[model samples]
Target chain A: MKSFLKLTYMELKLQLREPVALFFTLAFPVMVMVLFGFIFGNEAEELLGGYGQVDLSVPGYIGMVVGTIGMLSIPTTLANYRELGILRRLRATPLGSSPVLWSQVAAQVLMTAAGIILLFIAGLAIFDLRIPNGNLAIVPAILLSAFSFFAVGFVLAGVMPSARTAQAVGMAIFYPMLFLSGAAMPRYIMPDFVQQIAGLLPLTHVVILIEDLWLKGTWNLTSVAVVAVVLILGLVISRFTFRWE
Target chain B: MTQVIEVRNLHKAYDGVTAVDDVSFNVDEGEIFGIIGPNGAGKTTTIESVIGLRKPDGGSVSVLGLDPQTEARKLGNRIGTQLQEAALPERMKVWEALDLYASFYEKTVPWEPLVEQWGLAEKRNTQFGGLSGGQKQRLFISLALLNDPQIVFLDELTTGLDPQARRATWDLIRAIREQGKTVVLITHFMDEVEALADRVAVIDHGRVIALDTPDNLIASLNGETQVLFSVPNGFEAERLEKVSGVTAVHQHNQHITISGNGPLLANVAAALAQHNIAPADLRVQQANLEDVFLALTGRTIRN
Candidate 1:
């Protein structure tokens, strides 16, 4: 436990020290949210089945927050470590590799949460976007959605031959998911085939889960069920495939 | 002598390509043991097995009396390793790397002193990517020594350094030996092995062709003494080879060269003098590790 803490702290320190990771994970989503708040204005636009634009944007950007941290930051760090032999080098030490991995997970959780918080603060201050009524369900939806995204990243890091390849593959998957799902725009506007393809993406499920919790007052177990499957799939698959060298 | 590491008939292959074949050796405490070889000669594979990085296909390895594969967790804090082509995160600072490495061991040397000892004190705050090649190497050496390890493995630690930087790093390696730490150095560089290794094992094509002190290996090259000078007018090269202990003599351009075992230079000198021919540039070149490799494999180390 002591070693874990030390490693987590160092991992956070190392990651946060880099400007590129900080911008993509935290600042970029917040920047996009600020832009969305201005474009939507004080008037509520009917989108996503009569939900206000602000109502949809908040949940959608929250999906971006989790996706960016997961698909961008997590894979870059892990695959880079593997390419650099950092994982193998650490395995030779008493600390082993669990701390390095858990640290990444912890750092991702912390940073993703921070990005979400920034979105809320920006949302409340700029657009007066209030938290929806089903706040209790929002917590589980966000956590499960975030875990599934991180799991995708872990698997990418494990399977890619090098950090450069991981970054390339991760970004290729991330940008499309961001645009096709509800993260960049309302999924309701995408063509039927595009929407169906989005349905295959975890981000689409995350956005749906969070929006169901935020816009509708009802708890959506179906969305919860899908997100849980994704969560298990991500964690189990990544764990089995993770390689040190 | 305390045998800190022992390997018996270690063998390994990758995709049916043999990397290490029937290799065995022992490392004593406080000795600088070198594994010298050409590329793909299984030097790194052999060391990796000893350090528990790879499982041998056959035979066994024991380090500090514990099996490397099964007992790696126990050995982790005790052995330091600088693996070939391994690296730290690019943005990691020198001091942070040192501190992080130090945190892994239950007992650690003060990282502050190691920074200075490895000439990395000035670059303590510098990111790894910002440092020069030499500085990065020093940082790696510092990290290897951070735990005050009982044994350290350095594989091609100076493969890319300039001659000056290589020499400075060599001194640091000597200092490691002087401090009573067992060192395992793996390299294809002949000079590096000759300069720093107390004893060496020459590996070629996944086998140990020769194992002995550097001096013995070179001496076993049949002296292979090389004497070269401007061939005096009418100085007979064939006559020089006829002298006792002179196996062969050749003439190239304006120089005559003699090569053989035992007192070739002395006899060549006498023959040249008996002919009353004086060559100003006469000098005997000492046989090097490259010759030992050539004599064993009939090819240069670089090939």
Candidate 2:
């Protein structure tokens, strides 16, 4: 346990050094929240099921945070580690490779939580956003959403041949999911066909799950099942595809 | 002498294509054993197999009396490896890397002194990517020694360093041996083997072509020595050819090369003096491991 904490601490410190990761996880979501909150007032809107734009957008922004960390940060960093033989180097030591892998995951999870916290602070400070129904429930909601995305990220990193390819493929998947999954805009505002497509995306389920818990203090069982299935499926595929070197 | 590492008939193939075949060697304690070969000659594969980083398709490897495959974790604690293409995270600070790797082993020398001893005291806060090639290698050497392993394996440790850094690294390697640690030095540079190895296994085409002391390998070439000089306008090569221990002499225009055995340079010099022909550019060249490799493999080590 001590070794695991040390590894995770070191991993977090290393991840914090990356400017691109910081921009995406810490700054990008806050930027979007401020921009959207300014355009739409904080008053509860009938269109958003009586939730203010700040309240509704905060949970969707959390989905974006999960996506950015899982789809961009995790894949790019792990793939680069593999490409540079860092993973193999650690594997040669007496500690083997498991500590490195778990530490990386733990660091990403911490970063995801930080991004969510930054979003909440922005919502509260800028727009007088109301606190959610069940404050205690936010922990599991954020964790499960972050975990599901990390699994996808791991599968992408596992299969990508190089870091550059991983980044490119991650961006390719991320940008589209970001826009169509109600992460950038509300699903109710989109056309019917676009909403149907959004329903099929993993991020859409994440956004639904987070917003349901934040506003109603209840789980969206369907979104919960979809996100859970993605986590399991990603894990299975990564088992067959992950390459250390 | 105690044998710290033993490998017998180790065979490894990738996708049915052989990378190492029937390669065998033993490393004695407190000696620098070199595995010298050209690229793709199975040098890395052979060492990786012995270190348990690779699983051999055939043969057995024993390091510190433990099976490398079955007891890899135990063996890993006793042996340290600086792999050829392995690297740490670019953003990892020097001190952080030392501290992290130090945590891997059950016992370790304090990393602060280790880094200072490796001349990285000033670069403790420097990130891995900020280091020069030589500094990076020094950091790796320090990391490898963190556990104070009984045996250390270094693969291509000086591949990219400038001449001065290469020599400095050679001294560091000698220091490792001076600490009573058995060192496995792997390289394609014959000079590296000649300078440091107590015994070298010359690998080629995934096989151990020759294994002996560097001096013995060079001496196996009939101990041939060459004398070369630029002669005056019309000097007869026959004078030097008739000298005892002179096996062959070739003259091209103003240049003459004499190949022979013991004291050939002295005999040729005596004969040349008798003729009053004192060539100012005269020089003696002794056969080295490159020649031994060429003679064994029918090709130069590089091509």
Candidate 3:
């Protein structure tokens, strides 16, 4: 256990040492959120043209926050380690191999939380986006979304072992989740068939749960339950199929 | 001497091709044992299997009397290994790598002395990717000794090193042995086997073909010596073969070659004197490990 924590701390320190990656991990998502928020502010409703009267930019920004931290950052880092034999070297050490995986998960979780906080701060300060009326529900929504996306990232890292493949696969999942989950475009604007397929995606469910907490001040139990199920499924699949070397 | 490592009928196959086939050897305490083989001859696979990096299909391997397969985590603290082609992160500095690996063990030698002893103090802050191959090899060796382990495993330690670096590494390996640590060195360099190994097992096609000291293996070849000399004008190959202890003679232009077992040089000189032919340059060379390897395996070590 001591070795696990020590190795995890080392990993976290190493990740933070890369100035560019660190900046992008923390600052890029917030920059995108603020840029999109200012560009789409007040004009969001006008552009929506009576799509349930909900401010479209709020859900869009939330989805962006989830997608950047979850989809883009996680898979690339995991796959790079596997390809370079860093994971294999660590596994040969006395430190149990699970610590490396868990430490990465922990780093992503911490980074995701920071990114979400920045998004929230930017939304509240610049865009005048108010906190959800049902403040208690937002916690579970964010937590579930983080876990679900992390699991997706884990499975993606496992299946696509190469760094190039991880990037391609991350982008492949990222564009769809970004566009289809109402991050860039409103989900209400999509065709019914597209919405049905998008609804099956974990990102879609995460966005829906976040939208419920942030905009409506209510807990959507069914959506939260779906997110929970997807999180479990992703965890199991990654655990069984993950190849270290 | 007590056996520190023991393997019985170890076997490993990858995708239906056997990498290690029924190989067995033992390393006594404080002895530098080597497994010498050519490329793709299962040296790395056999060492990794003993270290528990790869599971053997059929075998019994015990390190310090602990089963590596079941007690890998526990045994890892006691064994130091420098694996072939294994690398750390590019941006990881030498000191960072050292500190990180040191943290994995319960008790670790201080990094300062290791850095000094390995001559890496100047590059401690440099990233791993920035170092040259010899520097990286030194750092790997430092990490392998960081835990102050009772046994160390080095795979192809001097594969790409220059002659100077190779000799320095050989000295360091001897230093490790002097410190009373048993070592398992895997290499294809016959000179390395001759210089450092106390006993060597020659592996070919995943099996041990011969095992003994370097001198014993050479002596076991029945004392064949190669004698070469530049014959003067008017010297014939037939006249050289008639010399005592000269079993056969082959000549190319002015150079004469003779193969024999006993009193070769003296008899050749006597015969040359009788023929009034004094060779300009006379030289006799004894057989080394390379000759023994070729004779036993029917293939040179490089091949």
User: Per-prediction DockQ scores?
Assistant: 0.60, 0.76, 0.57
In the range B208-293, model 3's lDDT, one tens digit per residue, is 88999888999898867878889766666786666767788888998888999887888878887777876877899888889888
Q: After superposition, how far is residue A205 of candidate 3 from its true place, in Å?
A: 1.0
List the candidates' TM-scores in order. 0.90, 0.95, 0.88
TM-score of 1: 0.90
Task: Write model 3 residue lDDT over A1-245, tens digit each, in one string.
Answer: 66666666766777777776667666765676667655655443534443222244555566666666667677888788888878777877778777787778777767766666776676667766544454676766787788888888888888885978987888887887778877666787799999998888777777888877776777778778888887898899999877777
Worst window of 10 by summed lDDT in candidate 3 chain A: A46-55
Query: Which digits, one per residue and each the tens of the lDDT, describe model 2 over residues B1-303?
Result: 999988999999999999998898889999999999899999999998988889999999999999988888888888888998999989999999998888888888899888878999999999999999999999999989998999999999999999999999999999999999999999999999999999999999999999999999998888779999998888888777789999998999889999999888888999988999889699999989999999999999998
The model with the greatest DockQ is 2
Clashing pairs in 2: none
Stronger candidate by TM-score (1 vs 2): 2
Docking outcome class, model 2: medium
How far off is model 3, as Cα RMSD? 3.7
TM-score for candidate 2, please give it: 0.95
Segments of candidate 2 deviating more than 4 angstroms: A46-50, B229-243, B248-256, B265-282
